[model samples]
Target: MQIYLPIAEMSVNLFLLVGLGGIVGVLSGMFGVGGGFLMTPLLFFIGIPPAIAVASEANQILGASTSGAIAHFKRRTVDVKMGLLLVLGGVVGSAFGVELFGILKNLGQLELIIKICYVFFLGIIGLLMFVESIRALRDIKKNKKRLKKRHHSWMQGLPLKMRFRASNLYISSIPALVIGFFVGILAAIMGVGGGFIMVPAMIYILGMPTKVVVGTSLFQIIFVTGTTTFLHASKNFSVDIVLATLLLIGGVVGAQIGTRLGLRLQSEQLRILLAILVLSMCFKIALELFVAPQEIYLLLRRI
Candidate 1:
């Protein structure tokens, strides 16, 4: 359990932290998420403070995402224009979110409130995605030929026409910017990387191909999370760099494995599995919200 740091004269629970990181990394790589949603909660369950959990996870995502983004960039899958717009929104949104966080911190019930909100959104989004994916699968099964007629969506005809060669989509810049802003605020406040929401938004809303979605999403995450980490470090000093490094190590390796597996997967199958996973997490969070925790003792624990 003891992990000695080379620079710092301190030891940590390396096994547990790395193991948790490994699980989160695999899930993140496979699901195309930053794993902050999972990492923050896991950190809390293992006794790390919420503030520290958020900051550390942000730092970890910075490294994990940077590496992933490089790989994606090398494959020529990143939409640079789209990524920049999202990052611009994300920067502004995170500032607002920080102010909101300050207000909520004074309220003292923010943890419970945030959990409730997380469960609600996760459930709603998950169910919607699941149903849609199922319907799409049925349609594909019924008539696979329907997919052959590749017609551009009406979104492509919207104003502020912009071309994304990597994603091979010509879409409206305004709409994409709006979506990015909305997702960025959520990412900042919830301490999530916004990949779960952003990827879907790009695929379903912006009508990008699934093949390029993951890479571009990771591309955006690098900047979003890196900025987040810097902000937390300079302002809050909450980032634990050592912790982030351990997580990044696990995440990078897991991502490579997941990328390979993702290539072998059928689009429908991947969608269905991802849908199920999202729904399962949604149900689990809801259960936690509805079910009361068991208090074993009248113990007052301090973080």
Candidate 2:
């Protein structure tokens, strides 16, 4: 299949890209993730250049997150202060990450390094989320009441407390900033949108309600990804705006459907399923790193 794209004149199959985008969009809508994690990998799997994949993912994330954030905002589900703090930290972290990427690229082990980190982090996150959700589910079943509000302690006692009216949260801003910084760096390094890590961090470490976590994370992602897009375009000129727009069309529609599906699932069920999917992918990727592939070499000699 040959398609003429506005950004690049290359013969490519249009259906594949759009289909991949649709799948990613569904996941994004369901989880409130930027979906770059899936999109970037899928692009690579389909033979796109790594640099192009990374740049395009950033651009696509900007659009998808912008749309998703708008939806979240309409629901009054975004924590603006927290999102901004995270974005600030994320930007700084992304700078460091970009430097690290350059260093690793020179070392010629960037791919291995990235894969190892992805697998390790993804596995840990998935397992923890899965276990937590299972417990939450059991509680919901045993007691027909919602989980009790956890009392804030040491975290809230820290200095430099800031109030977030939207989330009704009064906590130390430093913690969020620190968390965002690390998340941003990872996102930049791995070419992911960082929602996977950010969502968990916000809910567990930051003690934000899960209901608002997705929207707030999307808000931060827009800034983080937008910054990433600018950085790539300015330095590499790898940003494929047309490819991004194509993906965005599919992503936007998929997100709406996924969002509706998410509404039907119990919170615990959704978390557990998401956790399992994440962990399984992590394990699969990790196995590729640690396990050797079967050899199928053939040698022929004629005398």
Candidate 3:
């Protein structure tokens, strides 16, 4: 069935949209990402406008991450204080990012900008993860215990520091705020939950325990994505409710299935798989920028 998206002003296949959502959701559950990193591009590939994809994906993330956050809260794994601090910075960043998005849209540079951002970030992140995971995998094969290297102590040290009992850290609020703010901008611009970046920063940069990092990232993401969604809907009017609903249905189910599958896979394997996926996406998007379309041949004949 085909459905018209009023906001996006496009007609797309209903089942296709649902299937895309499920695929991204499965990746999200298995990899602990917001899926926006993958989903937003998938939307573009399927003919959705970049602005529409970003806005509607935010709504999908808000729905998908909600249950995860709630489950973490119930389990007492969420660091509420740190999460709130992240939210505080994310709100401001979200508002600013929305404004930037609008300006880029009006300037007719939105699609190019979004794709370039994806290509650049995904390439760098994917390469790093792939290298790191490969080493870990090799160590496992050799039955060698991985050495625990100390993390970088380069975290910021601004004033107004507080203790987070859940994370068991006595750090300055500056680092968390900064991380949240940067991610908020990405969320508004990239339509991601920002967990892919947020989780790593928490564990390695902020020195937060791995136990609480996922839950804390999800908790902050809920509010950040919510703010971004509202801004996109009100300012750009790009959010497609029907599209978001379809994605939600598929994402919820896919997540459950992915979680079960993830448990059966080794962590190193999963990281390597995800890294390959990300790099593949990055290369594909990069090709779009350089590859000439078939129509170019017809235009060249005139020359």
Candidate 4:
């Protein structure tokens, strides 16, 4: 059935929206990532206005993340203290990101900027994850033992050190704060939960345990995306509540399924799968940048 998105001023297939949510929700559950990286691009491909897509995706992420985080909490895999610190930084970053988004939209470069950011970040993250996963898998195959815990690095020497007992690390909060800030900015600008970036950063940069990383990332994403949703609704007025509602219904269920599946898979395998998905998205967006458009100019109606 077709449904009207009042804010977007468009009609779309209801099933299609639900399906998209389901797909992203599965990813969100499986990787403990919000799945916005995948959803936002799909929205663009389907002709949703960039601003509307970003704003609505943020709202959708809030629901998906909440479901996934609760599941992780039950497993006792979340680092609550760490997640809160990240949220502190994310809030500040999101505020700046919203203002910047408004400026870019006014300049008529929002879509291009969003696409460019997607391609750039996805390419870097995908390559890193792919290479790391391969090495990890190879070591496992060779029966080589891996370190149970990461050693102290430069990051550990930084100021504001705090103990994250769940992850069993004494690390500086500054790094975590910085990471959250950047992820929040990306989340606001790109309409993602920032899980893809946060997951990897938590793993390699902070040396957080794989078991806890996804849950912690999801916890922070909830607040960041929630803040973005409100800002977009009040400031940009681009959020389509009807669209977000449809997506949430499907996404919530999909996330539950994905979370269960994640428990059965090896960490390396999950990272590899996520990397492939990221690279695929990066390629798609990059291709659009080089490909010629069917129409060189768009005609807008005058009020």
**Backbone clashes in each candidate structure, one number apiece?**
0, 0, 0, 0
In candidate 3, list every pair of residues with a backbone clash.
none
- lDDT by residue (129-184, candidate 4, tens digit) is 89988988999899997765465567756898899999998888998899989988
Which candidate has the highest TM-score of all? 3
Q: Point out the higher-scoring one by TM-score: 2 or 3.
A: 3
Order the numbered candidates by lDDT, best leading: 3, 4, 2, 1
lDDT of 1 by residue, 1-303 (tens): 687543232466897787778877876666566777767767766666565667677778777788777878898887888888778777777666655655565565446655675776677766776786788888888874434223246765778888888778677887677767776666555667878788878877877787778787787777777777777666655677877788778777777777666667765556666667666766776776678778634432232
* Residue 59 in model 3: lDDT: 89
lDDT of 2: 0.76
Best by lDDT: 3
Error of 4 at 188 (Å): 0.2
Query: 1-303 in candidate 3: lDDT tens per residue?
Result: 999988887889999989988988888787666788889988988888888899999989999999999999999899999999999989888999999998888777777799999998889889988998999889888989864433456544467778989988888898889999999999999898888788888887888888898899999999999999999999989889999999999999999888888888776788988899989999999998879765643211110
Clash pairs for candidate 1: none
Q: After superposition, how far is residue 150 of candidate 1 from its true place, in Å?
A: 11
Residue 108 deviation, candidate 3, in Å? 0.8
Error of 4 at 269 (Å): 6.3
Sort every candidate by TM-score, greatest first: 3, 4, 2, 1
Cα lDDT tens digits, model 2, 63-172, are 88787688889998988889999999999887777667656655665666777876877788778888878888887778765654443576867898888887778888
- Regions more than 4 Å wrong, model 1: 3-12, 132-172, 209-212, 262-277, 292-303
Cα lDDT, model 4, residue 61 = 84
Misplaced by over 4 Å in model 3 are 145-157, 292-303
Local distance difference test, per candidate? 0.70, 0.76, 0.87, 0.86
How does model 1 score by TM-score? Answer: 0.77
